[model samples]
Target: MGDVVEMTSELGFKYSILASGSTGNSFYLETPEKKILVDAGLSGKKITSLLAEIDRDPSDLDAILVTHEHKDHIHGVGVLARKYGMDIYANEKTWQIMDSKNMLGKVDNSQKHIFSRGKLLTFGDIDIESFGVSHDAINPQFYRFMKDGKSFVMLTDTGYVSDRMAGLIENADGYLIESNHDIEILRAGSYPWSTKQRILSDQGHLCNEDGADAMIRTIGNKTKKIYLGHLSKENNIKELAYMTMENQLARADFGVGTDFKIFVTSPDTATPLTDI
Candidate 1:
């Protein structure tokens, strides 16, 4: 924890995992000149409160970026945008699905912005880019934010990380990736066989082992922080997810507290603000 604080204090950008899991998912990122919310999965009031927990205000956010149209990813998007009058950016396919389902309510034309998949866009002092991820949603994607020489990747809900996907986000200073379930637990748990199959499918969520492998393939000399997010309350234990990552990275010659630090995100609370 002390190491985390020391490293964060030395950096120019900070971020926190507001909430992460099946119930809801949101992330808050702050640069010297910009405040960004990657997703608002909780209610508008809840997100505002989460922001306040970290001494931020909803109205001060420069933009709200959407990765996909899943309810757990966009539940509060419309309300946040409407209430704060902030710009919301998403891919055209995501916007189409959200609009078709009325998922974001009534966002004004001025508040809706679209960016092409895999293209880079600048927001304030940050450079943001989105890339395709394998997930069961209309054009599901994730983002990598770069400012100065540091980069942070917000990646979740993807079932598999192809070499290409890993390459795009490689060498990021920090990452927030899903370590959703333990295969053994999911296979033995009582989530209906079909649901289990879906989660185990190619378009489903990444299990703990896969998530760890993704991190191993992406970690570089500059990587210092890793956030294991989107755990399954029924299928995964926080400690188990953390250990899985720690153990796997260890085999690859990475030390948990020395090479980099690991943070396990929660569905009900905010993680410590970290910078990299």
Candidate 2:
């Protein structure tokens, strides 16, 4: 938005989602001195190529943070970390569970870091808070990254947002929230009943209705942008997801473009780098 407030009061962090969906998921976060990735779901080669799209060097990454052990979230974590010699952080239970399953192949012990939920972590000038999320995976978390006075949250793969989740991310300047499916489209599609039920379940994914409602509740007055993400290719179209959220904002008397901005992420490619 031309007149909407940006990070004028303080320094803002850089953010971009390399991919977000059933196929893969990743987000890149950078402050002035630190560059980090959240999840390496795509192949290592593909991840690097996406980095090249933004003129970023994978070798320069400072760390990799995993949300969970799902293949779509961790498929490339081991390969990328080993190649770049960077450390990775995950909850201890997730780390132990993933390690036992041979998910990441053989990362060195030193490369593995454990961060408990509800703790404040610092990397350079960046401040991160990892809060528990309602996902099926063991010890899943959604992250909010802050630098200076601005913050953004990379939130996905959660079945629902709890009061705590809403509280943790309500003040972010930007949000990458999951808008996984359209309920009507999903129910009318050809998927089996069980698959549909699973997705509709609390531990499955967030539908467009719930996602939009969450966005409406969580955004602070100064929140600048909201990116609808993790859409299902089979059930949800990007336009539908975007419009659903936009309509919600409009219904609340908020100007969609002038008061705030919105973007949708693709399953196939990375979104343009976002300045928070």
For model 2, residues 1-276, the per-residue Cα lDDT tens digits are 488765553378788888999899989988778999999999999999989888898999999999999999999999998899999999999998998899999999999999788778998889899998887888898789988788888888888888778987896888999999999999999999999988998888999989988887788787888888889999999999998999988898877899789998887688888788
Clashing pairs in 2: none
Off by over 4 Å in 2: 1-10
Q: Which of the numbered candidates is closest to the native, going by highest lDDT?
A: 1
- The TM-score that candidate 2 achieves is 0.94
TM-score of each: 0.94, 0.94
Residue-level lDDT tens digits of model 1 in 65-108: 99999889889999989888899999999999999889898989
Question: Clash number for model 1?
Answer: 0
